[model samples]
Target: MIPIQLTFHGAAGTVTGSCYRLDIGDRHVLVDCGMFQGDKTIKQLNYQPWPFDPRRIAAVLVTHAHIDHSGLLPKLVKAGYAGPIYATPGTSDLLQFMLPDSGSIQEMEVERLNRRNQRRGGGIVQPIYTEQDAQDCLRLLAARDFGSWFDVTGGLRARFWNAGHILGAASIELEVETGGARPLRLLFSGDIGPEHKALQQEAMAPSDLDIVVMESTYGGRPRPKLDDSQRRAVLAEEVTAALAAGGNLVIPAFAVERTQELLADLTRLIADGTIKRVPIFVDSPLATRITSVFAKYLHQENGIKAGAARPFDGGNLRFTRTVQESMQIEQVTGGAIIIAASGMCEAGRIRHHLKNNLWRSNATILLIGYQAPGTLGALLEKGERVVRIQGDEVAVRAHIRKLEIYSGHADHDELLDWLTNRLPIHGSLMLTHGEPDAIGALHASIALWRERAPQVIVPKLDETYSLAKAQPRLMKMTQQSRRLDRYAETEAISGHDWHNDYARLMLQVQHQLRTAKSDLDRRRLLKKMQRILGRGAGTD
Candidate 1:
């Protein structure tokens, strides 16, 4: 039997609901059981049963605290996985805010579904995970610091490095040994951040790896580039323009970083008296709690630790903790600023606020994050004339604006550079966590990579590979010089003519090469085709 195997269970070909499983002999580990967000088709996958047995997992290793990457932990526990879940201390703190809030979302969704079910004489519906499940899940979490190696499975040692994608975000590296011998190193590059973010430290790249899994969220398209100064200038201008026109600016942001960053910017503007200190309200209870977490960790921030005072606590910054307080935001009348979540406007207090203010011509909706393809946030960002909220259609008469600086993921060119700098040529690569177009673009880009150096593989969900078993195919193709041998046979068979058939065969070969998961597979197939075609016996 082979020593090690890696299986991708989630985050393969789609951007949300990330989960992966690793096995070495009798030991097993699961990584990042996240909930799927975005289109209803993708979100529905979250309700389906897991592909593997949760009970068999020895432990759960979380990469970060983002809901798309950590939301399903409670559900895993509820389904009877009692093992310790490991993460950095910062992730643990964020989970304290994320888990219960996710539970509340699940409860709310289930309640709404049940009421509809009753109306249609269908059975009562239950939440996928409850707050109690989240509490139980928390008891099992063991927070560890980065840069320290810990024994993870029977023959596997693991460590984390800062990903800089979010506070306490990490990229996981695992060294697996089978039968107490033959070490295999695999690195999981969780969501990554660019070098330019304000609060995060710079991202780190490792020197070498046997297999590397990378995310490709922005691989297909380039995000609009603007320097930090330009971003801030645009934001300030939008705010002042809205206020000058007697409009209140409403921003739907991720509670952790985007909300706080926007608030910090507003505080700077108001303190300098560049803009009026209009009433600003944070209307999501989850955001309110997360803001407290951020404050507690202020010393951990890059520049803020040097005794830089935070403006989130006072001066027009108000946190609304109750539904009533959130609803009261409607009475702010004019020229106030409001921030809320879920950033996509799919749920949470933002929907309530959007429904109340969307019809008003004087209101402005500001988007600060990546809106998934089928989300309400995407609709608004695309200038849809109407959006449905809570089963009622609301006219999108409000001014819609965007500030792209709020993105947490790295862009296209950044992804390629990260891969080239971090991984040795011998290492294999897996591209995941993107839509089909993004993944396809990255897949093509990696081919150019394979032509020069290193083995690359774009893995798919449920594709299993024996880590040790893949070495020979790569060795044979590189050492034997099969292309040279094919050339020699081509010279001997040059007189034969079958151009049309050869073209058809070549087209099929190209398709297989494009679809093959790894360079090793491509090499193997090329060698086989060389033999089958009698080395250029036909012309194209």
Candidate 2:
């Protein structure tokens, strides 16, 4: 009998690029081929070739339609994977709009880079996947309803359970039959949702598992159990504060769930007269389409109950899809709410809004979702007084408010409860989809489950585990050995980065010296270099 095996392709020690593989005998199955986001290191990881042959993979199971979980499917299809990609109906619907949008964004980014490369006489660049590639990949998708058992190749049975993280999100349950080896079961928690989401259901409980894979995105901290009323109250106050200041309330939102949720909250607030009726502009085209989908398919639509007023029916809401409509938003001097994406202010219409509103003393920039490190949103969240936007430094006079209560992922305590609520978890627990500190913190929390001393495994990127040979045992690594491994990697990366930065600074100094037309200009450049050198030395 062949032994079943598992491999981690991505999201091993990071919050994005979630991919996993299960090998059975001669065939393989995959779950989630997503794009990586965040700092340069994370984005660079996407440039690496796929670890395995895409053609060899028999099937793919998508938990949801978030870019970090499903963005790379078109690339997989382009790489010759002719297998069925399974997803829930809602996820499928979202992907139809989302994937092509991703392709378009890639094309735009590549065009921008090529223009720069052209000036430098560099090679031409191409997008990862074209819109046509995404359209081709859509033909391979098969929508499966939640709770339906589906069969994969190589005699494996898989089931999808609602994750409640977003519309059509699901947790995957796989039943593996390896030569009648007692038919083992495995559960993959595909980004578990927090409780009491405005438009989402709670994540289903996990049960009857031999081995379980979990996400630890929020493991390092816990979110307070803020209910609907509490969230509404806070949102009203934030909006009121923005309104009183007599400037726009700018919200950088994820086009999917976050946009829908915010619209629902706004509708309720307006209905109850908690805040003045303000014109709310939905600025992202993708978000506008997604909102329409929710209105059509979900019926009740984003916590706006059956009898409640619709998000756009109040006549104060506007959908800006064209450049003309988007630019017109700048003309609004005060008391308007502008919602746009890319959520982290990394790209798209949000940057324009930030450039306009961030300088206003009365403007309130409300961050309602997670902002990855090195993103413009993170810089603002960290209280950077001035930031560069579209080649200009803009003063950040706007008040910034982060309402993490709007986050959809399960937090530390909620993860614990989600685990404890399930029965027959007599198997090893492996944590992924988080940074080392978060994974480590979550691993330590397992000690409280004294009834069974759980064997916790935090697998590194691309690590493999054999299910046939040994149980998922505790990794008893020596502290010295681990320290060396960690430090060796850090030292090498830091050394390379230091050299590059030093070279860039030297080039800047050389250019300024060469361009100096007068003694005053030379002295100014000298003073700037001194300040730069002093700042660099302070870090050292």
Candidate 3:
């Protein structure tokens, strides 16, 4: 059998851009041409040359529709890739709105930047891909169902298994055949969701994988043991606390699954009377459109398949799709909840909400997902006394509460456990899509359990690996690979320090409430909390 090779085009040293090239002799399959995110240096990588000629790419396989995972398709198409883009029905549906919306956002952002640049006599910039460029790529998309293996170029066959990260995420299983070598079975874990995730099935752990290319986003620290019940209680308690403060709770969420899951959790809490019902406003137009696609496939066998709705229902829940409706939210004094997007607080309506409420002592900033470094949200989570937003320095007096347990990525323990079940003793695992620290933690965790476990590698951009006897044989990669040590203790995603502590407290309280054994125990725990707050035991 001939030797097959895989190259890391992106998402190697740092998180965000996720691109990989699998070359089987003369044919090439590209997976996930995602955009770069986080700090400026990384974000600029989006404009870099196509590592390999796009025209030579045979096909593209998209695991989901998140901008970081699928944003650069238009750029690829713009680079002259006229290949079939494969994804699930839900992803296809989501991209119908997401891709175009991304284009619009890019254009709008560039326009704003250019106006400022023109005033300063600085060079104007153009968008990476135009709205029309995004539109053109849509015609190339063909939706395929999960569990169905289809023929890709170069005699490769691939099947999608539910990843459970986002609405339509999947772990790709590919069968690679080299004419001279034996067939190699490979699984690509596309941003795995946590085990206790809501509204989604457990991430599929398919067996017999010769090589596993998986994400290690949370590999650095295993999030503290948190159960779904405790997570539910914490959500309820946070809403109650926010309402009790007589101010609106501003939740910065992703427009995709994170927003949908939070809404579903809040709805359940209201139904159970775990928390009082309040006016909930979805303040982003992008989120509103994406939520509609989620609803469209909510009951389909290939879609969300979670037998419920009301995530987008009720008079209590309002969707603000225009600037007027979003502006009107400011008039709300208290007893309301606002969920907004641009999860990182880099842009979108969440900034407006934060600007409107950050100085209010009674208001609460409820963070419900991971915040990459250098983002406005990360600055807030880091306990910065003042943060600049829209050119105005805003005080951070509002109660900033973060719940890390709401993270969609699997933690260190869960990721290792998942690998343990699917990997062989000598199998090679390439860890991608995470900060160096996270990769190091998981890398060590693997050695801790099985001393001779699979070879764990933290690959560098442009690195290449070949398979021989089902084991990875490292090929000569670019000099960048040599600079990134697999065992280095470099820091990646140190996280919002204050935010992690606050989130830990939330999880701790939730655990205590859930494990309270009896009513007396619960009251005693509440009394202790009251004492900590300097409130009388008898007071509410």
- Clashes in each model (backbone N, CA, C under 3 Å)? 1, 0, 6
Best by lDDT: 3
lDDT, candidate 1, equals: 0.76
Predictions ranked by TM-score, top down?
2, 3, 1
Model 2: per-residue Cα lDDT at residue 45: 51
Can you give the TM-score per candidate against the true fold?
0.83, 0.88, 0.86
In model 2, the runs with Cα more than 4 Å from the true position are 299-312, 473-540
Give each model's whole-structure lDDT.
0.76, 0.81, 0.81
Clashing pairs in 3: 1-179, 1-180, 1-181, 2-180, 2-181, 220-438
Q: What ranges in model 3 sit over 4 Å off?
A: 224-228, 305-309, 477-540
- Residue-wise lDDT of candidate 2 within 258-295, one digit each (tens)? 98888888888888899999899999999999887777
Regions of model 1 farther than 4 Å from truth: 179-182, 224-228, 301-308, 450-453, 469-540
- RMSD to the true structure for each prediction, in A, is 14.7, 5.1, 12.5
lDDT-best of 1 and 2: 2
* Displacement of the residue 392 alpha carbon in candidate 3, Å: 2.9
Superior candidate under lDDT, 2 versus 3: 3
lDDT of 3 by residue, 1-540 (tens): 665788887778667889989988888998888987765546666776676889999999998898988999999999999999999888898898888888988998899889988999999898999889999999999888899999897679899998878888988998877664556788889988887776666788588678899898888776777666778888888888999999889999999988888887787778777988788999988888888887877766646644245655765889988899999999986889999988888878898899999999999999887888657887788897667676566778899999987788888888887887785634688999887778888888888766658777777777888776767777975554443233321322332334335544665677688888998999999888878777555545
